[model samples]
Every structure is written in structure tokens, then in C-alpha cells.
Target: MTPAQIIQAIEGMEPAMQRAYLEQVKTVVGAATVAEVERLIADEDEDGLVALLSLGALSVFLELARSVFIAGARFEVKAISIPRDLGRFEFDARQPAAEQWVSAKAEEIRANATIDVRAAVREVMGRRRRAVVWPAAQQVQVSATPMVRTPRQSALDLLGRVSAQTGSRSGGVIGLPGNYAQYVLNARAQLLGGNPDEMRKYLQRKRRDRRFDGIVNRAIKAGTPVAQADVDKIAGRYADRLMKTYAEMLSKAEALESFGAGRDQVYEQLIAQGLDRDSVTKTWRDRGDKKVRHTHSVMGGQEVQKDQPFQSPAGALLRYPGDTSLGAGWSERANCRCSAIYKIRRK
Candidate 1:
């Protein structure tokens, strides 16, 4: 469909459709951003595409951290100042009334799970190549070495890359504003390693820490007659503690915002570089049977029921799953397989 036509389809949908339909449109936008930049910039121009797409690695890390608190967790964004050459991010977060908030949002958390790395990205690109108008008529593909890494490893590597990229002088090709880029980098990095990040591991340990195992081992070592009921009681308390601890580490918005801010640096640069602002349209491309994720059943069910239209962010791209383009969305926005299709027609 033409870019304008796809947008029309998007605007006509109900709010839920508008919100849930635009899945991985960000990834597609990222791909389109790179392609459009290559079209305008010379091959001799230093390649800054890697910096553009690498933000996905940060996105994955933040989402995973937030998921730890998905089930009724709460957090508040607090403003803070830190030195540059660290990363770009200024807002800090605190959860003052977390214990109270968890009681209310349990349903929302249980229903929404962690977004998938591949699927989250696939939706951005959608499944099919969108036929778009360019200076030269042709199809385009974005080759981003999908940034997947072990949790600790990803945290360290992403922080290093972000610091290095943000630390560089601003006037260069991948233009991050000099004064604020470092702040944004540090803010995003801090979210990945926030109290919640560490708390997530601790909460899990509350349920399965080796202390319980040690109880069993010690009983046998001491030649103490350990009753099966007593062992079961100890294990049960671990489960109780795990749940209690999870409730205590309420998730907040700081990390998701930081990740998106990092993404925004690249997207804004590409738009300025020369991708047609009007030509790019948002359309909801269904994940189809091949890409449907079981976790996103609530959202996926709707996409499967009918043809979902795409909703463009106008110029603003979606940062993460819960982020919406307009006044629309669904309970199952997380891990949605649908993509937000963007087409660039040079006018």
C-alpha cells in the first residue's frame, strides 16, 4: 500500500488497534533510517550506521530489567546530575510507595511479560519489504548484527559502546548534541544497572537461594533427623520470600525512557540527514502465523482477527512496546509481532 494509504488505515482504527498494531515499526524505522542516510551520504563518509542500530542492545537490556518488576511493581523518576564522558541521562528514579503500588497493578504485571529480542526487532522491520519510493527506485534491507548478549556481558559492553560514542565530539557525522549526549548515555546506562536490575537477581534468590539447599545438606551432615515436612516448610518460605521480595522491587519508567532517548539520538540524526519526513508512514504489519508470539496472545489475538492498519508516530518513533503513537493501545502491547511499516518517498 502507498505510505499515505497505510496511514489512513491506521487513523481509522480504534485506540486499541492504533496502539497494539504498531509493533516493531521502530526497527523498520531504524532500518529505513540507515538506508536513507546511505542514499544521501557518500560511501567515503564515515559509517555511523553501527551507532544508529546499536541502541537496540540497550533497549533489550532495559526491557529485561523492567520485566523483573512487571507484576505490580512501581517506581518514580527522580532528577539527578552526573558528569559527562559517562553517558547521556539526567533523570533518576525512586519508588517511595512501591509496597502500596504493587497491590494495585498485579493484574497488569501478570498479563504483560517481557518483550522478545528478535520479535521486538522483527516487528520494526515487519516481515515483508515495503515498496517505497526513493531517489532511485529499489528495495532496501538493513543489516544490523543483531545485538544479543549475556546479561552481565551485555550490560558491560553496551555501557562501553554508549560511553565511547557519546564521548566523541558532537560535530562529527553521527551528531549527538555535545552538552547533553554524555548525560543521556550515563542515564541510559545507569537504568540498566539500577537498583531494580540488582534487585531482580536478589528477588529470585529469595526463592531459590542455596541456603535452602544447604539446609538439606547440613541436616544430613550433622546426622540430624530432618523431617520431610520440616524441609518442605523451609522451601515454602523461600517461595513466600521470593514473592514478597518481587513486590518490594517495583519497576519504574527511568530505564525505558533512557533506552528510548538513546534511540532518539540516532533517529533524529537520520531525519536531519535527509529521509523524507512526510514519506515515512506507519502501518501495522501483522506478525502472521510464522511470527505470532504465545505470550502476546491478548494483542496477537486482535491482529489475527482482522487486518490491522499501521499508525505512524508522525515523525516521532516508538521507543519501546508500551509506547503509543496516538490515543490508542492494548493490554498486550508487549512482545507484539506486528510491525510499524515506514516508507520513505523522496518528494
Candidate 2:
């Protein structure tokens, strides 16, 4: 399966598993989103609401990110030929230097997850605030104690899961590194899209949440009589919408969070097993925009344009996930679901 397919499969898991997964997230941001709405109704604390939203976003992000990494790892092994048996990655450790590189790179990416997740969390928080002019919580703190795993825990947890994935589901595809190499390419897309993915979802949900808060807060602060129905709408009606939106967003974001930080480990594994500079070629998707960004569109295929998104021997487009390789700044990242395809050439 392509990274895109893997992302879809994970997002479209059994309903029961999906519910179980979300129940975990609700313990953090899900509940907070509701409580903050109530707080706005009761205490008229706009800043507190914003802070809560930010914290809630952080919590959601951490959980989503962890899920993405695990899903990506699982897909990596299975993407190639399914192993005759499941347990023990088919990694060839013949090249000590390559193996070492993979291990070190994985750690490096894992460590960087905290920074990336935090930044994405803040972007969501800030975007939500801007949408409704949600005031600063005289004490806006994004980390009201993350409801889910701490960012670091989430990162480490991803690495652990990837290790488990390798042990349990890889082996047999000797000298065939397309799956491993593709995993890295796909993961970079996942990592790059994380911030925008969550931010878009937050922006949509909070736009409505805060809008409701504004209406109720206005009536309450003005000593205006809020209709009983209005009160109910504020607390219950929109809460349902918030959750529905959240579920949708979770699916979308996780698809993007399908992951990051584990690219190093994946790359090294591929290299140790014989992947090389020419092993993975990064290709662009031609959206066929009459006016497309030079970065991705310049490549010029019916599916890709010409002369953009520089490609290096290392892999597909020189640009990784977070870079503005798309050119319209971060907005391009949000809309560009374009993927990195990995093809292997062997003598």
C-alpha cells in the first residue's frame, strides 16, 4: 500500500477500535473542549477558554501523532511482500555504518517530534484564537498538563512501536528496499503536514465553538436574558457539532500525522539492507493547476509539472514535509496531499 493507503486504512479502522482510541483522547482535549465552553457560559473567561483550547489541542496532537507513527511503521513492513511469517524485520545489517545511521537518525527524528508537535499545537491554538478574537487567557498556557502522553513520551512511544513493528512483521524481502525507502518518504509527508492538518481541524471546530461562546457571553455579560433554548444550544447543540467535527478532524490529522520522527530508523534500515542513493526517487504529483507552484508543479508530468520541488539522489523532491517547498507558505502544505513515491532499481 502507498503511504496514502496506509493512512486511510488506519483512519478507517474498525469502529470499535476507533471509539476506543478516541476515548483515550477525550480524557484530555475532548473533555476540555466541552468544559471550556461551559466555563465561558458560567465564568465568561475568554482567555481561560483560549488557554484551555490550546491545551486541549496539544493533548489531541500528541495522541494523534503517536497513532500516526505506529500506523506508518506497521505499513512499512507490510507494504512490501507480506512476510512468510510475522516477527523479525528482514533488515540486512551487513553494513554496520548504515545500520548505525538508521539507529541514530531514528533517535534524532524522535527527539525532534516534541518541537514539531508543540509548534503544531500552538498553531492550532493561535488559529482558533484568531478566528474568534478569542482573548488571551490573562494566563494562556498551552500546557495545562497535557491530557494524553507528554510530547516526549509520545515520541519515545512511537520509536518503541516502530521497533516492535520491525520485530513482529518484517523479514524475507532481501535486497528489496522499496518498502523501507518508501516508508521514509511517506513519513516525511506525514511529518510535514501535521501542523496544518490539526490546525485546520481546530480552526473549523473552534470557529463554531467560540462563535457560540461569544453569543452566550454577550447575553450573559450584558445582563440580557438568554433564552432557555439559547442556553441549551450553547451547551448541548454545539457540543455535538464540536465532537463530530473533532472526529472528522482526528481522521484527517492522523492521516497526516501518519507520521514523522521515525524516518531515520527507516532510512538506515533500508540502507543497511542495500538501499542506496539511486534506490529511492522522489516524484511530484501534478495537480494540473493552470497556475501551480513552481516547487511541485515544475516537475511537469501529466501528473506532475516541470522544473520545481528539487529532487535529489537521496530521494524524491529535495523538500521534506515541513519545508515551504510548495511555495505558498504553509497553506500549500495543508492542501497538498501529494505523496513521495519510492521506486527501487537493482542490477
Candidate 3:
């Protein structure tokens, strides 16, 4: 049902049910409507019928789910890096050497150098009138073809200029012969979700998680003045809140393993809000199983307990669940490790 229809359903419930519905609305609907709904529900509920309105409350949840998803999805940022120095791209430019190469190659052709006398008729001569016979050298155009330089020569010229700008060969970092820009490209590509293929779906998810973690770390290091110990302390507190909230939230939606249609729509909305959205999505893709243990062992060596479901320093609002107006959502705004998620839509 539409949001308005959902609101109306809540409104029509008994007075006591209406108050309970308002509590649900604050958590699910948003801030702007909370006061209005509360006032309306309170005004109309002379007998507290609103408290018993379970169906109406559930409908509100299903409808408002999209909005929450949208807000959450928009919580992340994405970075796109471009390729440098496309192969053979330099050939397209109208540089003299490259252009001269074309002309020189054409001149090297023997037939082009030996012009035939008969072929060189004066403009005034009629088609049937043959021109005076002359040697091929005399008749041939005197224009000489320029020498075509070898590819090696062209490369050397390029290297010579580079060397001139930065001392001699030994002055450089590595004695690499190929394009060094590729390393930068590889690093950035690896950080972003690499090629969609090659790696199965799991690899893509892992790549995305790393990318997000990198972005988060970079942002935090740049802004926060806290030391590692301080940050850890902060994260610890937030994680405690996060674990509890997720436990409660998950329980509310039992057996719902995937994002349903409305939930998927909300996920897209949250992504647009500038959150580290892909991280959240990857989290779900990587670990949505209800039975999956949070902590695990690495090669059966050191046991790495899952600290908390969400990032600790980032998860502050688990204790302050309210409608969208209170900015409870923004509590996890910049550095919160909290993830916004939804059930995946199925066919």
C-alpha cells in the first residue's frame, strides 16, 4: 500500500492502539509525520484502540521500509578511477614524426618514384594527344620521399626527452621498460570492485569490502585526531550497541533471508545518500545466513572472533531508535560502521 494509505490505516485504529502505532511510526515512518500522526491518533483514539492495531502497524512497516532502505543505501561513497595512456592513442595526434612516417612510407614505393611520361600530360593537351616521351627520371615528380624512422628510433626519441627532464637513467626509481602507470591503474582497480568476471560473486564482494574499508580508513585518518587506542575504545562502545540493535532488528524480521521488492527499492535510496553503501550490500552478500557464526578461525591457527557485526566507532545509534526526524539515522553518518541493508528481491 502507499504511505498515505498506511498512515490512514494506522489513523483508523482504536485510541490505545493508535499510541502504540505512533511508537512504531516514529521508528519506521520518519520525523515529519510523527508529530502529525501522534496528534491525529491521540485526538481520534478516545478508547485506546490504536494499541491493538497490529495489521495496520505492519502495513506501515512494509510501506516505510523503502524509505529506510533508501536512507541507508545513500550512506556510502564510491570512487571511480580511469585508465591512463591508452595504447596507440598517441598515433591519433597530428605530431610531425608520426605524420611524416606515413608520407615517407608512401615515398619508398618504387612505382610512385618512377612516374611515366605519358601519364604526365599537360592540362591543355587533348585526351588523344600523347605527351612528348621523356626518361622516367625527367618525367617523374622530383619530390623526394622523406625517410621513415624505425619504431625503435621513435621510442628512443621519447626516452631521450624523459631522461633530459629527470637527470640520467640511474636517477629514476626502477629500470622498467614498460608503462609504469599500469601499476597505479592496477592498484586502483583492485581497490574498486575489479572486473565483474574472472572472480566469482564472492570475490567481487570481497573487493568491494576492501575498497570501502580503505575509503573509511583514509577518511578517518585524515579527519579524526584520536589515537589508535582512543579509536578502539570508541569502536568498542559502538560495537556493543550495534550488536544488540542488530539482534533486535533481525528478530523482528524472522526467516526473511533476502531483500524483498520494497526493501530493495529502499536500498537504492540509501545508496544515493552518500553512505558507504556498497560495503553494506557486500556485507549482506557475504554474510546473510542466520546460522553463520560471527567469529571464525584462520586456517585453524589463531581464532579471530568477530568483534561486532557493524563497525564499532561507526555504530552509535542502536540505543537511540527513533523516527527519521530525530536524525538518529545521521548519528551513524560519517564514520559509523553501521550498515544499511534489506532483503534481496527474488523472482
Among the numbered candidates, top lDDT falls to 2
lDDT (Cα, 0-100) at 190 in candidate 3: 28
- Provide the TM-score for each candidate, comma-separated: 0.23, 0.40, 0.17
List residue ranges in candidate 3 displaced over 4 A: 1-54, 57-59, 76-347
Give the per-residue Cα lDDT of candidate 2 at 284.
41
User: Model 1, stretches more than 4 Å misplaced?
Assistant: 1-265, 290-320, 324-330, 335-338
How badly does each model clash, as a count of residue pairs?
21, 20, 42
Ranking of all candidate structures by their lDDT, best first: 2, 1, 3
- Count backbone overlaps in model 1: 21
Over 116-198, each residue of candidate 2 has an lDDT whose tens digit, in order, gives 33443333232223322212331142223222223332221111111233332111111112222222222222221223332
**Candidate No. with top TM-score:** 2
lDDT of 1 by residue, 1-347 (tens): 33233223222322322222122222323243333433322232212323332223333323443332231121111111122323453221223333232332333332222122222222222211222121111112221222222333222211212123443211111111121222222222222222233223323443344555554444434433233343333433443333233222222222222222232222233344443445343333444565444433223222211112323333322323234423224333423334333333434
